[model samples]
Target: MLIARWIFDIDTIDGRSAADVQGAAPAVVLDESVRVVPGRDGEALAFDGRAQAVIPAAPQLVLSQVFGFALAFFVNVTAPPDGEWRGLLYKPVGENDARGVGMWLYPDAMRVRGQVFTAKGPDYVDSRTSLRVGEWTHVAFVADADGMYLYIDGRLDVGVPLEHEVVPPYGPIYLGGQPDRPGFTGLLDDLRVYASALDAGTVQALARPPS
Candidate 1:
């Protein structure tokens, strides 16, 4: 089940709260840098490559201490200009590590990175797929006992197995951008996070625009 879904359809902003259409959690608009822009479905949050909105790691937003998790969103990239990694959705993987187990955009590919503490084994895994610019694209990432998967526009493009034990992350989830990386220079809409890994069919269905 999805603990929260931020559709960003409403323009109402009471203080720092950004309502979650799924009726679970509200993201605190950090620094008031993000704005609500008319998006693919209705409305979306726009980050100016500076600020980010964050949903705190409340009990409801935290996933179970398991490897199963999934995230999906609709994005339209207007300009990436630089090759700097831009975060789409992220959760701090470790306190010491600068990177996280989350989705990031490269110059041409979108990557999902994750790692587990280990002296040996498949502790680090990543999935990547090329991305198209100037249009709305549906992206999805799933990590579970089966491994990590990345989907673009609902199409399964990358999948890898988790060969070692990995602890789940309980840190706050950031959308639009991460702490160290640049915010997305575009619009984001219909963001969702599920506690369980979704199958290919389910992910494809989710990619369909609201009708």
Candidate 2:
């Protein structure tokens, strides 16, 4: 059984929000199963959990100064047509703007995909690789001023070079499903986000179960 060392204790220095910030000591108590761990070598947040649920206020509530995010989850499929497993990183956009990037796992493959629409319309792109079913796979994205790289189990599968310079604003970042399209389903565990690029050593540390 997995135990949460620190669920929603705001008194600790690593607490999730201002209400829960270290010293404020809010009375928040997360569901018994969810745990947040400090990232290995950087100032990042990571979560470990057992079910498919959303951290609704993830962006504004939890993340600050985050430039890159990654999610690793288990795909439990007892039968055919296994559900669509996707992880998204989103920040607020103006009503007229349509641009962001996400990584997804379809039944056949996994993809590094994104969309951009200034005022003309929406443009989209994707790079996919075949993936195994009903297994726990590590999917990660590292984004900076240069562009984004999609990784599977710590190895680069596809690189989406930016046509123009791209930078992630310090707004709320989301995971698990598209903000616009909710209810796409899967089991996500060990989700993480960082303010800086996670190096190989850090990624390996994150991949390991907490001690």
Candidate lDDT values, in order = 0.69, 0.39
How big is the positional error of residue 60 in model 1, measured in Å on the Cα after superposition? 2.4
Worst 10 residues of 2 by lDDT: 1-10
* TM-score of every candidate: 0.84, 0.52
lDDT of 2 at 208: 54
Those runs of model 1 whose alpha carbons end farther than 4 Å from true positions after fitting are 64-67, 94-100, 107-128
Query: Model 1 compared with the native: what TM-score?
Result: 0.84
**Model 2 lDDT tens row, 75-173:** 322122334444434433332233433444444344435443223343344556544444445565555444456566666666654455443332333
RMSD of each: 2.9, 8.3
Q: After superposition, how far is residue 8 of candidate 2 from its true place, in Å?
A: 11
lDDT string for model 1 (1-211, tens) is 7877877766645566677766667565655788887888777788787768887766666553264778888888767447677767776644434334566676445444444332233355455555566688888877777567778888887776766655555577777667666866888888888888888999999988778
Clashes of each: 0, 1
List where candidate 2 sits over 4 angstroms from the true fold: 1-99, 106-128, 167-183, 208-211
